[model samples]
Target: MTESRTLYGYFRSSAAYRVRIALNHKGLDYTQAPVSLVKGEQQAPDYLALNPQGLVPALSDNGVLLTQSLAICEYLDEAYPDTPRLLPAEPVARARVRAIAQAIACEIHPLNNLRVLNYLKQELGVDEEARNGWYRHWVELGFAALERTLANSAGPYCFGETVTLADVCLVPQLFNARRFSVDLTPYPRLVAVGEVLERLPAFAAAHPSRQPDAPPA
Candidate 1:
């Protein structure tokens, strides 16, 4: 049996959302501990001890703390090989999947995370309109490249018929982009892929709306 796991995350953090999707995709049962980033709970002394970076989606598997959503997802795939695979079996295809995932996770997400936006506002004295402009600017630039990449490779999911690591990363980023009012019309391929992925039970269950810490609308 795979060991038990606990995930410390916020309901709306896209990084946390990615981990939840990966966990559900593997049908792994995990308890979620909400570390509310909005409430500043992530900076608490106890939580900081678990992850000094104060990021959401820190995973503890069999008591070993693991940070970074992509790493945690890959770790789950390795630790529970019996489950549905997240990466392609072939090395080149796996690299393709990883590259797509990183396009959103590494290239785009970092600049738009809560901390960065907060810094632009509180520390840099940017207004709400300017902060939103910064958010949309990065999303559009990243998604423009991502759209071309997905158009070349996707067949329903990012890597073809199978749901790969790329698809896991895509859904949450799109959700966040929408939150900032990023115009998604240019990326029809991404929008189409996301539409299909959103309906899957695993993806549906992991949606921000369904999280235990999800605030009422």
Candidate 2:
């Protein structure tokens, strides 16, 4: 376990959820500093100093602060080479895994994230129904393409039998999709991959409901 690893995040934030899974999967010890997104804690001056973008997840590794979920996951994989890696050693396989991860993180997530939704509601005054429609549109569009990409996979996970960064990114996005009532029936392959990944101990431990900031049942 590394010393002084602190993750500033919101329990329900998909980006933070990704880092949580990576930390748990690598068997790393880290402390959680919950920055409640719903309560606007991420916008506070303290958090802004850590991450000027006012994002939910900003990891502090022995005071070496890092922002962006994918970058942090990659950092962990590189820093702890002895631990289970989130990326493959082979060039082609590594690129493929990153492609899947980015399809979700870059294409789908950016459109449907909390800030974008809030912008539509608070700034443009979009109605709840339209906001939900907006969410489902981007998810379905991205998942449609992602399903085709994963159709050739011979695996229980996104890339293969071995879990990679792709698997880590998929589970949290699925959780967020379900929260918005997005119909996942169109992407059975993606959904199947997600179901298998979610059952794993690390993924289960990183679930939003399992976080310390999560609401009591």
Candidate 3:
């Protein structure tokens, strides 16, 4: 009824992955409506109407359509503030959490997303090696800075003892990095934080591999 919400997302989309982590962290109940990116299901007329940009992680909540991963997460935070808050109450600390989140979402992810990679191959005529190089280049550049940020933070989580927006963003980006064979040795702090977060039940449930639409082995 009034509380019902549904998420339209692909299993492997990191943007969707971020929202999944946020939902799990908040312990929210929702229905998943898979949008198969590899199969181009996102471009279907129904989904396109839901998101004109044809992006995954679009949420339909209380009859309102919301798009963009970070914006959706913030909406969830605002709508359900009584649950565990994703951002710190202090303005400065909240800014720090958001800065870390954007470091991945704004800087790292867009450059290596599926659409961007597709453009590199179809339009720019990039070969597989060049595409992978593009992926690694951005991941490495982002991770280098993230490693330093995590080193300065106090915790098993990104911000502090409790999970925050930064951890939600970090875990998924690290997942992508490992999938692409980015060496983790150079970023021990980031790896350590990810390991700690991975052990938590919320994060474990949000992993792409565990999603219902995840590709078969």
Candidate 4:
């Protein structure tokens, strides 16, 4: 029997969202320990002990501590090989998916995450409009590249018909883009694929609005 899984994360964190999608797609049952990033709860000494980086999405699987969203997702896949695979079998295809996922997770997300935004406002003295402008700029750049990369999609998901790591990463990034009011008109392929992916059970359940900590509508 698989051991119990516990995920510590902020509801609205894109990185945490990616892990949630991976876990749901694999049909894994995990408990959530909400870390309120907005309130700086991630920095608490207790939380920091769980994750020295003080990042959301630190996971504990039967007492095996895991940090980093991508690493945790890959670990789940490796540990539970019987579950649906997030990375493809073919080498080239797997690399391509990783590239796409990283394009957002590494390049785009780093510049626009909560800490960076707070640093821009509190440390750099950037105004609201300028801070948002910073967010929109990186999102547009990343989406443009992703749109072109996915121009050859066979349909229904990021990598052909199967949901891969790319799709998991894409959904949360797009959600963040919309949250920041970034214009998505420039990336039709992204918008269309995202709409389809969001309809899936795994993706839908992992949405920020559906998370337990989300504010009431």
Error of 1 at 208 (Å): 0.7
Deviation in angstroms for 37 in model 1?
0.7
Residue pairs that clash (backbone atoms under 3 angstroms), model 1? none
Off by over 4 Å in 4: none
Per-candidate local distance difference test: 0.94, 0.94, 0.92, 0.93
Q: Is candidate 2 or candidate 4 better by lDDT?
A: 2
TM-scores for every predicted model: 0.97, 0.98, 0.97, 0.98
Q: Which residue window of length 10 is worst by lDDT in model 4? A: 152-161
lDDT tens digits, residue span 1-217, model 3: 5598899998888899899999989999888999999999988999999999988989998789999999999999999998888989899999999999999999999999999999999999999998999999999999999988888888788898888899989999999999998888999999999999999888899999899999786
Residue 171 deviation, candidate 3, in Å? 0.7
Looking at model 4, the pairs that clash are none
Flag the better candidate by lDDT, 2 or 3.
2
lDDT of 2 by residue, 1-217 (tens): 4489999998899999999999999999999999988889889999999999999799999889999999999999999899999999999999999999999999999999888999999999999999999999999999899999999888889998899999999999999999999889988998888988899999999999999999997
Off by over 4 Å in 1: none
Predicted candidate 4 versus true structure: per-residue lDDT over 1-217, tens digit per residue = 6679998998899999999999999999999999999899999999999999999899999999999999998898899899999999899999988998899899999999888999999999999999999999999988998999999768778898899999999999999999999999999999999999999999999999888888997
Q: Give model 3's TM-score versus the native structure.
A: 0.97
